[model samples]
Target: MASRTPAPRQQTHLAVLIDADNAPAAIVEGLFEEIAKYGIASVKRIYGDWTKPQLGKWKQVLLDHSIQPMQQFAYTSGKNATDSALIIDAMDLLYTRRFDGFCLVSSDSDFTRLAARLREEGLTVYGFGEEKTPKPFVSACDKFIYTEILRASPEAEPAPSSEKSTAANVEEAPKPAAKPKPQKVPLDFIAKVLDDIADEDDDWVHLGALGQNISKLRPAFDPRLYGFKKLSDLIKGHPKRFELQARGATNGGSKDFYVRNAGIAR
Candidate 1:
C-alpha cells in the first residue's frame, strides 16, 4: 500500500492599507483582529502626512502594532496628496502579485475606484470603514466592515436604570426599547445557497465547502457579521433550518462536519 500524500497548505496573504487621515486610531486593534479571521496580513501600511499634529494619536500606536506609516506631505491646500500616494502604492503592490487579497481601511469614497480595480484583477478586496461610508464604496469591495462594529466592546451591555421607590410615585412614561440589530445574512439566503451547492447524489455538503460557496455568492458574507465566530456555529444556530452531521475524516482518525437542508431526507 502506498502512503497518502498530505494536502497542500493554502493560506491567504493580504496587504492591509490604511488611510490614517480618514480612519480612527482606536479601531486599529480590532481591525487587525478582524483581518486575522480572513488570512495573514503580509503587509501593513498606513498613508498620511505624519508631520501633521492631527495624526499624533496614530503615531503613538504605530510602533506598538508594527504598522508602517508612509508619510505623504500635503502638496497643496485643497488637493489630497495622501490619497494619491496610497493609490500609487496600492497599484505598485498589485502588480507585484505578492498578495492574495487587500484590505483597504478608510471611510473616504475616494478609494472606491481603487477597490473596484483590484477586484477586477481577480484579487479579493476587504474594506473597512465607518457606517456613513458611501454605498458605492461599500458595494465596490468583496467584503465591507463598519469600523464602529470593530471598536464595540464585546462584553459591554446596557446599564440598568436606578429609580427610587416612593409612595408619591406616579405612572412613568415607558422608555423606548433599544432596536435589535438587523440580520446581515438572512436564513433564506443561506438555505438557498446550501441547496444550490449540495451534491445531488449525496444531498449533503461539507460545511467548509459551503462557506466557500457562500463567500463566492455573497462576497461580504461573514459569520462575524452575524455574531458567530465560525461557520459551523452559524449553521448550528439555525438548527431547525439545517441539519449537521459529524462523520469520520478521510484519514479515518478524526471527524469532519457536514450539513444539509433540514427538509432534505438523509
Candidate 2:
C-alpha cells in the first residue's frame, strides 16, 4: 500500500466588514483582537456615512486601525443604505474566492441572510454584535460574539464634577455597593462540551476545536464575560476540573495545546 501524502495547511484568510452605523467604536480594538483568533483579516472595511457627525468617532478609530472606510450615503429616508452597501460589497468579495471566511460586525438583523448565504458557499461566518442582536442573525453564523464582552473595563475614575457644584455645597447620595457580575458561561458547561467533543480513543481534544465547539453550543460564550481574556486562561483557571497539555510540533516548530476533562484517565 502507498503512503498517503499529507495535505498542505493554509492559514485562514478572512474579510472583516463592519457596519459602523450599528456597531460601537469602543469595541473596535477588542474586536480585532478577537477576530485574530480565527484567522488573518485580509480585507478590513467599515461602511457608514462619514459626513454625519455621529460617525466622527469612528474616523479616528478607522485611521488608527488601518481600516478602510466605505461611504454609503443615506439616499432615502427611513431606510438603511449602509446595510445595502455592505451586503453588495460582501457578495463582490465572496465571488473573488480569496477569503476562507468573513466576519460581519453588526447588531442589525439585516445581515442574517447574508451570513446564511456565505455559509452555504462553505465559508465560515463569524458574527460580532451586542446581546440584543436578533436570534436569527446569531444562529446564522458559525460563531457569534457579543460586543459587550469586548468593551473596555469600566473601572476608570468618574469625570470631574461641574464647577457650579462645590464640594461643600453639593450633597452626595449614599453610594450603593457594587454587585458581582454573574457568570455567563458556567465551568461545568465548558467541561461538558469538552467531554462530548473529545476524541473517543484518547478523550483529548485540541483547545482550538474545543473553543469552536463551545461557541457553536453557546453563541454568547466568551472568556471575557467571565473575567478571563482568553479561553486558554479560562481553562487554566480551573486546573482541578480541566487538564491542559502542550504538545510540541513534529517539525520542532510551534506547540499545539490540548485539553481534556480532569476526571478522565490519563
Candidate 3:
C-alpha cells in the first residue's frame, strides 16, 4: 500500500502592475509566462483609460488574462495618471504585507522611486520594461526583465543601439545624442583578466572577478546593455566569445563559482 503526498506550494506572491502607456499590448502573453517563472501572480492590475480608443488593443488583453483594469482618465495632455495610481496602489499593497514581491511593468523612469520604496520595506521587486528603461529603475529592482527580448522568439535581437536609452523617453528630459559605433566589449581590460588568470595557472577566473576587472576598467559597463543579467548569463549567451566553467569553492561557503576563458568566436 502506498500513500500519496500533497505537493508543496510556491512561497512567493507576485503583484503585477502594467503601465499601459509604456508597455506594449502584445507583451501580455509573454508577460504571464515570465511571471510564472517567479511565482503565482495573484494580483494583476493595469492602469489606463479603458474607454479610450488608444487602449482598444489592451482591452482584449485584459479580458483574456482576467486582469483588473484600473481606469484613470488622462487629466491633462501628455500627462499620465497611470503612474500615480499604480504607485498609490503599490504603497497600499506594501502596507498590507500581502505580496512577497512586486512586478513593476513600465519603461518609464517614474516608477523608479516606487520600486526602491517597495524594496525598502523588505519586499523583492521584479521590474519588467523595455530596453529603453532608465538605468536607475532597472538597477533599483532585484531583477529586471526586458520585455522586448522576452517577446521575441529564439532569434536574438540586434545589438542594443547606444542611443536607445537616451532617446527612449524624450518627453521626460533631454539627453546627449548618439555617437558613432564603438567596440562592443573593452578588450584591453578583459585581456588583462585573462592574462592574470593565465599567469596564475587558473584556466578560469571567477565571473565575479571578471566583472570587477571590467568595472575597474570601465565604470559604466553594464551586462544589461549587452543583453544579459549575471556575468554567467551574459557569458553563456556569448558561447563563441567566451568559455564558462564551475570552479571549486575557496573555503566552506558553497556559493557556486563561475569561470570565463577567452574564445575567438565573437
Candidate 4:
C-alpha cells in the first residue's frame, strides 16, 4: 500500500445523513457536537416523513440544527422509505468526492451495507446509533460511537452495568467503591497481531503501519483496552518488547509510529 499524508487535525469536509425513523430526536444536538470533533458537518441532512405525528419532535431539532429534511412517506405498513432516500443521497454525495468522511446516524442495520461500501472507498465512516444496534453494522465503521455516550448529559448520573457503548468500549463491572485500572491489553494477542503483520512485511514493519494493519484485522483492537489513548502509549507501557523512533528530527516528516521484534511474547 502506498503511504499517504498524515491525517489532518480537521476533517476537510464531511457528509452527515440521519435516518430519522430509527434514531431518537433527542440526540441530534449532541450528535452534531460530537461530529464537530472530527471535522465540520458540511452536509447535514435527515430523512423521514415529516407528516407523521411520531416525527413532530424531529421538526424542532431539524431547524435548530439546520439539517435538511428529506421527505419519504411510507407507502405501506412495515415499509421504510427513509432508508432508501438516505442511501441514495449518500451514494450521490460519495461520487462527488467532495467529502473526506461520512457520518451515518441510525440504529437500524439497514445502513450496514452503506457503511461497509463507504469504507471500501477509503472514506472514514463514523456510525452513531443506539445500544440496540446489531453487531454487523457497528463493526463496519472505521469508528462506531454509541448514541448513549454522546447523549450523556452532565446532570445524568452514570448507570451501573458491564455494558459498553462501542465495540471498543469494554468496561469491567463496578466494584464495591474501589476503582480498578482498565483491563490491560493481552500481551499474547498484541504479539499475534504484530507477528502476523511482521511476517507479511518481510520481518520489518513500521509501528504506525502495523497499527493500521491490526485495525484491518480487528476493528476493536484499541490501545484504550489497556487504558491508554494512543498505540504509542500502550507500547511504551510494554517497552521491553517493542522498539520505537521519533521519526521527524532530520526531516519535516513526523515520527508518529513504531516497529516491533518478532517472537516476543508475554
Candidate 5:
C-alpha cells in the first residue's frame, strides 16, 4: 500500500478596494492586520477625487501604506461617481481571474450589489464598514468587519497637533469614540447550533470546526463583539453553558481546544 500525499493548501490572493469617502483613513493599520488573517492583499486601491479637502488626510496614509489612489471626479452635485469607478474596476479585476477574494471597504450601502456580484462569480468577498452600515450590504459578503474594531486605542494618544479625524465624517475634535456596550452572548443559539452538528459522542466538537460551523450560520459572528478577544475566552466566560478541554499537540505546537455542552454529563 502506498502512503497518500496530503494536498498543499492554496494561498488566497485578495484585492482590497476602499471607498475613501466612506472609509476612514484611521483604520489602515488594523485593516491590513485583519486582512492578513485571510490572505495576502495583492491589490490595495482607494477611489476618490483628491481635489476635495475631506480626502486630504487619506493622502498621507495612502503614501505610507503604498495604496494606489483612483481619481474620480464628482461629475454632478449629490451624485457619487466613486462607486461607479470602483464597480467598474472590480469587474475588470474579476475578469482577470487572479484574486481569490476581495475586501470591499465602505459604510455606504451603495456597494451592496457589487459585493453580491463578486460572490456570484464564486470569489470570497469580505466587507469592512461601520456598524451603521445597512444590513443588505453586511449580508452580501462572506464576512464583515466593523471599522470601530480597527481604530487605535484611546490610550495611544498622539500630540495635540497630530490629533485629527480619520473617520468618514472627519469630525473636527478627534475625540475617543464612545463604542456601544457589548451585546449578551446568545448561549441558547450556540447550544442549538452545537446540537445540530454534534454526533453521538455527547455533542463534543473541535473548537476550530465549531467556529466554522457558527460562521456558516451567522456570517457576522465574532467573539470581539462580546468584548472577548478570542472565541475560547468568550466560551470560557460562559462556564455555566459550555465546557472546554485543551488537548496537547503531538508536534509540540500550541494545544488544541475542544468544547461541549455543559448541560451534558460525559
Candidate 6:
C-alpha cells in the first residue's frame, strides 16, 4: 500500500493541560484520540474545583483517563481560580523543558497569552476549543482544533436477544454518528498559499510541506472544519481548483505526494 506521507521517527512528548472550568467532559475521549496523531501525552493534568457539582461529571472521566486533577478553590465570587492554577502549572511544565509541546484545552480566551508565551519559548502548542473560541486564542497556538469537531464515543450496542423480534432488532441498530457541522473552506487562502509557496517554476509542491505552510499561515486551519479528514482530501475534494501527484513510492512504502493549483497546468 502506498502511504500518504512518511511518518516522523519519534512522537513529540506533550504536556496536556485542560481548564475544566470551560471545557466539557464529553470531549475527553475524542480529545485524546486527536492528540495521538501528534505524540504521547506525557503529562495529563486538569485544573478545577472538584468539590463543585458541575465538575462531578469529570471525576470518573479523569480516573478513566488517568488524568491527575489539581484542586484549586474559588477564593472569590467573581474570579477564576482554575485558570490561574492551570497557567502557573503550564509555566512550571514549560520551564522543565521535558515536553516537546503543550495541548491547552479550553474555549476560554484567557489562555491566549499563555499560548503565545509557549510558542515564544519555541515549543509547539495545540489549542482545543469550541467554534466560539476567540480568534486571539486560536491564532496564538501552533495549530488550533475546534472542539466542535471532537465527539464522545458512542455507547455500546446491546446484544440481540433470542426473544426479540427481527424487526425490533433491525430498528434498534445503532444510528450512524453525526458529522460535525460544515464550515466554509478557505478557498481563497488555499489558492493564495499554493501560488505563494509551492508553485515552484509553476510546478507541483510537496503535500507535506504545503500542509506545514498552511498551518503556519492559519493555526486554526483544519480540514475537519470543512468535513474532510486530511489536507490531501480537502484539496482533492476541490478537484476543479487543485491538482495532485503521487511520486517516489517503492514496494508499498510511503510515497512523496505533491499538489498544485490546477491552473498551474502541471
lDDT (0 to 1) per candidate: 0.85, 0.88, 0.75, 0.78, 0.89, 0.89
Clashing pairs in 6: none
lDDT of 3 at 189: 57
Residue 38's lDDT in candidate 3: 80
In model 2, state the lDDT of residue 260: 90
lDDT of 3 by residue, 215-265 (tens): 544434556556555567767766665677765676885665565556532
Ranking by TM-score: 5, 6, 1, 2, 3, 4
TM-score of each: 0.75, 0.75, 0.64, 0.63, 0.87, 0.86
Tens digit of per-residue lDDT, candidate 6, span 113-148: 999999999999999998889999998999999887
Superposed model 4: Cα runs more than 4 Å off? 1-11, 26-30, 119-122, 156-188, 198-207, 220-266
Error of 3 at 108 (Å): 1.2
How would you encode candidate 5's per-residue C-alpha lDDT over 11-83 as one tens digit per residue? 9999999999999888888899999999999999999999999998899898788899999999999999999
Worst 10 residues of 4 by lDDT: 172-181
Measured over all alpha carbons after superposition, the RMSD of each candidate to the real structure, in angstroms, is 7.6, 6.3, 11.1, 10.3, 5.3, 6.6
Winner by TM-score between candidate 5 and candidate 4: 5
Minimal lDDT window, size 10, model 3: 174-183
RMSD over all Cα atoms, model 5: 5.3
lDDT of 1 at 169: 70
Off by over 4 Å in 5: 1-9, 156-173, 248-251
- Tell me the lDDT of model 3 at 161: 57
Colliding residue pairs in candidate 4 = 207-258, 247-255
Worst 10 residues of 5 by lDDT: 157-166
